[model samples]
Target: MTTLPAPLVWTFDGPFERCLADIEDTLRRAIVMVGDVSRVAMLIDLSLPALKQRVDAGEALQPAWGRFLERMARYGLPASPRVRHLRGAGPLATLVIAYRN
Candidate 1:
């Protein structure tokens, strides 16, 4: 019997607006790297409200995540992003990505 490791998830906790940039940067790198691989298959779970607070704070969520989503879509991979609104939190963000080879 063998065990498989869970997919990689980047957690940039702290502040949404303040940490949005960092999340974008991290996701970009992962997407680029995974896209270049021989077998292009990846999974991402961005279902945390805390992760989206920054963009949801009147920051045009679509444009904010446009590049990364476009890249993932172009690569023909499945990116499941779960975004929601939550009250209370000071500029905290996080990015989580999963890939399978």
Candidate 2:
């Protein structure tokens, strides 16, 4: 029997590009720490209201999100990550992502 490492959780509340950079750095460090990138699984948590606000504010979140996923794929992670939306979280937008094996 093999036990998996604890999941790596990250919270983002800023521009999409910075978020992507942070996530990318986290993934790189995690992969190096685990020494096996293939066993990693990613979970992305997005706020529905926040996303809508971004769109209403004239920010292209959808396309940016898509591009972020594409960047993750380049690191050998899954392009299609599991996502969950939380309601009544508040006005501040937050993106939470978890990587696990």
Candidate 3:
């Protein structure tokens, strides 16, 4: 039996745009550490209210999100990542969990 490494987790609580660079960097590092991108799975948690507010205020999230997906694809991660929005009240928060699947 082989032992797998623990998941890589990252939590972002700020403007979505501001954290893109950091998020990409983290993904890159994770790919390097795991040695196999296909074995990785990602979970993203975003504050519902904050996201609504941004959308209501005419902020476009699709472009940024597209870029993120592109980065993941480039890193050999899955193109279709599972997204679940949970009810919550707080500032913008993005949680990413990457682990061997």
Better of 2 and 3 by lDDT: 3
Taking the tens digit of each residue's C-alpha lDDT, what string does model 2 give over 4-60?
Answer: 447766677655556666767776886776667776776666667766666677777
Q: TM-score of predicted model 1?
A: 0.42
Best by TM-score: 3
Per-candidate RMSD, Å: 5.9, 4.1, 3.4
Which window of ten consecutive residues has the lowest lDDT sum in model 3? 91-100
Writing each residue's lDDT as its tens digit, candidate 1 over 71-90 gives 44554444445444345453
lDDT of 3 by residue, 5-37 (tens): 566667665666756667777767776677787
Which model is ahead, 2 or 3, in terms of TM-score? 3
Q: How good is model 2 by TM-score? A: 0.69
Candidate 1: Cα lDDT at 19: 47
Candidate-wise lDDT, in order: 0.49, 0.63, 0.69
Q: How far is candidate 1 from the true structure (C-alpha RMSD, Å)?
A: 5.9
Best by lDDT: 3
